[model samples]
Target: MNIAEVSKKYEISADTLRYYERIGLIPEVNRNKSGIRDYTEEDCRWVEFIKCMRSAGLPIEILIEYVTLFQQGNETIEARKDLLIEQRKQLIEKMENVKKTIERLDYKIERYEQSVVTKENELKRTDD
Candidate 1:
């Protein structure tokens, strides 16, 4: 598919896709004779992987390093695994922080709800 099709399919902007390619976050896509990008299945898979990793809050530097290691062939397998493990650890930490924030918000919401109910009850007594 072309860049536009790939961008729409992946819900990513074409400029971002080009930026990824330019930044070595993903492999360069093959261009057609007219100089338009023609995204093959492998290229699309790389785009998907990059998108997923980015969505998970993985840093672009780490992803670029991972892609560099990936392109170096089989010898970097352990290095790649180690890099991903570190990223996963960081992501887990972030997830924990987000969960705590959600819990705090839930507590505050419940408190406000209870306060509203108490005020309503007091108003009913005053009305009677």
Candidate 2:
């Protein structure tokens, strides 16, 4: 597919796709004779993987390292796995923190709800 088609399909802008290619985040795309990018299935897969990793808060530097290792053939398998594992560990820590924050917010909201109910009850007593 062309750059425009790939951009629309992946929900990414063409400029971002170009930047990814330039930054080595994704492999270079094959260009047609007219100098238009033609994205193959493999290219699309790379784009999908990069998008998922980015959404999960992975940094560009880490991703570039991963991609570099990936391009170095089978010898870097362990290194790639180690990188992913470390990132996963960090992501888990972040998730735990977010969970704690959610719990605290829930508790605060419940307290406010209880206060409102108490105030309503006191108002009723005064009315009677």
Candidate 3:
């Protein structure tokens, strides 16, 4: 596969892929005889993984670190695990905060509805 094919398969732009490579977020891609990018199955798989992690709100800096550790062979496995765990913890905390905000919004909406009803009742009494 080429860059175009990889881009279409991952729903990512070619420019973004190049940017990832340039930023060291991903390994440098191989080139063909004409110097065009020659993406392999492994490359596409890594792109998909990176996209998924990014969409899940993982920071690019952390991803770059992870990639660096990955390039250093298997000795960095523990560090990689620690990084993922930390991100997961942060994501959970953010989710909890969102839930609290949603609850507050729901309470405010209920109070507004009650106020509207009370005003309607007062208007009806005044008309009597």
Query: Best by TM-score, which number?
Result: 1
Cα lDDT tens digits, model 3, 1-117, are: 999899898899999999999999889999999999998888887899899999988889999999999999999999999998999999999899999999999999999999999
How close to the true structure is residue 111 of candidate 2, measured as C-alpha lDDT?
A: 100
Alpha-carbon RMSD, candidate 3 = 2.0
**Candidate 3 residue 60 C-alpha distance from true site, Å:** 0.6
Candidate 1's displacement at residue 73, Å, is 0.9
Off by over 4 Å in 3: 116-128
For residue 15, model 1's alpha carbon misses the true position, in angstroms, by: 0.5
Q: TM-score for all predictions?
A: 0.98, 0.94, 0.84
Highest lDDT scorer: 2
What digit string (tens of lDDT, one per residue) describes model 1 on residues 3-83? 999999999999999999999999999999999999999999999999999999898999999999999999999999999
Quantify how close model 1 is to the true structure by its C-alpha RMSD in Å: 0.6
Clashing pairs in 3: none
Ranking by TM-score: 1, 2, 3
List ranges where model 1 is wrong by over 4 Å. Answer: none
lDDT of 2: 0.98
